[model samples]
Target: MDLRSHSKPIEEFNFLDPAVLDNPFEYYRAAQEQAPVYLMPETGMYLVSRYEDLRQVLLDTETFSNNLDGYGMLQGENWKVHQGILQERGWPDLPTLNFTDPPVHTRYRRIADSIFNAKRIAAISDRIEELCNLIIDRFIDRGECEFVSEFSFPFVGTIISEQLGLDSEKMSTFKKWGEAIMAPTSRVMTVEELRENAETIVEMQHFIAGKLEERRKEPRNDLISALVSSRGSDGEELDMMELQSFMRQFLSGTYESVVTMISHGMLILLREPGVMEQVATDLSRVPDFVEEALRFDTAVPGLARLVTRDTELAGVHLPAGSIVMTRYAAANRDPAKFDRPDKFDIDRKDKAHLSFGTGPHLCVGRLLARRELVIAFRTLLTRLKDIELARPLPEIAHVPHALLRPMKELPIRFAKADAA
Candidate 1:
């Protein structure tokens, strides 16, 4: 694959060139080996695709930062637009925990860490299994079903909403409002359409505020009340802005990415009948299945960072202010990291993939996400005896701008459930 061809000049590199966007790997692989720090002339940012380099950048917050501009620019995402969409408009702004750097990151992490600790993880397994059973029951009899709409879409959607204490009536609106905020700049609607969409965001913020008020008057044992009642180790309550920030954090990563895992995971397994059969015969193989899916098609393809000071990594001298893209899509598939990286294996033994990231910014909600996938997969396959895709694998549709690679829909037909 002669990676050196891409090392010609930074000016020659076009990060968003149409072909590579459709097929990023062919270019990304070249970038990783030939020019691990090549600059993208199109977006005016540096690209990093190797596993080792990305791991370092993710860990060294001091060297690599995540300020908006530093995080690599999404097309049409300007500062004024950023401020308008994320801040004043109140579009699920959770204080930028994932995008913010240390000291602050450490401080904020401790607040949620206590709740997401080891014991808490072990405690939820049974309940997750139970929820898995209930969700699978709907599709069990039908055998054939749209996997996304039936399970993945609603699984993450319902799990987090339930965890956060959102009521049944408002779930649909909550999801719609969430989608509007998280849509990539390239995918967002036209200017007039955007203004119309912004109103939905405003209403969502109001809904959250209203729910907070209600929770205060009548408390419940859920994430919302815990957040409302939470105090820093110092016994200080989170300020109004902090509460808003926390909720935004929950929505941005937790809901979208986890749901992405299920949807994308199902798509891959369905495409490979052998893999599906392997899992169908033994539900216990789900953990490996989920891990392989993440490695094969990581949900968030890249994590961008800013170079704080002039530094050289892997023979590339990066300039300060270089917007570095840690391309997970490339890194996970790097031949150096995994064997036959393209072929989806149900029993991949490597733990080198960075789908949920590595080091400081490693996904905090990882436990919850893994549980959801395991439960969902085991439940559906076990209960629904024979399920198959409705159309050919290549005919499936997907929303390209989706940072989370989820199937647009998954139509299937299976045997009917037996009468009890």
Candidate 2:
């Protein structure tokens, strides 16, 4: 399975390169233009960035496959998460959907569905709004704040913990751990970080397991209690390992993804004050603004998939096994699909953005993610009377990872949008 003998060059796959990683629009655009489907000597895989082309790969999971290697998350670099879980065989397991294809993927989807169902989300809508207001209130007087650290990170951090029936304190710990893992080029976590990650993942598994046990003895109205004691359609609970695996996936995936939403969303609003004013005045329009933000600065730069069978995508033909990298960031901003694609337009009503992805594997947490975003922007708009970039946009730094596109820091100040 080693493609090293016939591998592509990754001069571009210097996905870890600080300059390229921090701002990758031009590279992604170039790759998409060269070929919607082409093997890079650099990334060592096929990249699908055109909106039409990427949709085909994600929607048609059968031809594409979802096995560990096929999906980007479980590639060679992620061996520890998948294999380690099996060895532990219990509470301390890595719950990653990054490894499974369909049938198995379907099972995990059902488990996720049971808890993140739309109705359940609706039930918590008010509470989420309340939490958003509370957080916004804290920063409204200051008028400006670091949206990621001051707002998005802790808001979702607390809310996710409450949903899982875990402790807020533990959720804080997971936030740091999640940031480390998500930062592909994290300076703080050197190679030694991997060893620390092993320890963190193990501790995370145990923490979830303990919570699962607690929920079991005294079932609550939360997602964990439902998973620990609830049944599938057949009325049987997920085995211990399955339970832990689910939590692992849930926590890891959402942490950075939500962080991306906040960071990208702030960057756009700060740059385009008219959009922010409209969104602030009419909070109902936030979803559209958020959608634009998702497309304008897509958090996930791209996703990689290894082809399991020889096939034709776009017009390109390939062998049975190939690595496909789909670039959502490029496609979202593609002029072919979006009018003024390069510009941020909240009034753009077409919600066809590829930010949440297309096809069966559509992001499971999208609804919740949007809810948090809506509440967040509404609060930011009303709380801060005026907000602007704390630093020059060009000088500001970006997160050092290809996995998600978010900034590390943003200094903003504003007066409460509301006089009260």
> In candidate 2, what are the lDDT values of residues 20-59, reduced to their tens digit?
7787655566655566676766555677767888888888
- Cα-based TM-score, every candidate: 0.86, 0.88
For each candidate in the order shown, give its overall lDDT on alpha carbons.
Answer: 0.70, 0.70
lDDT, model 2, position 350: 65
| Tens digits of lDDT, candidate 1, 1-420 | 444334344345455554445446667666765677677765566777878778888889899986553211452543344446546656434444666787777777887776566676567677667766777777766556677777776667776777677764466776786676666433435555555566666766777777777777887866787778777867888876677667767776787677777877777776787888898787778888888888887877876788889998888788888878778887888777787776787767786689888877888888878877887777766666556777764443555552444456777776643333
Model 1 poorest ten-residue lDDT run: 70-79
lDDT of 1: 0.70
CA lDDT for candidate 2:
0.70
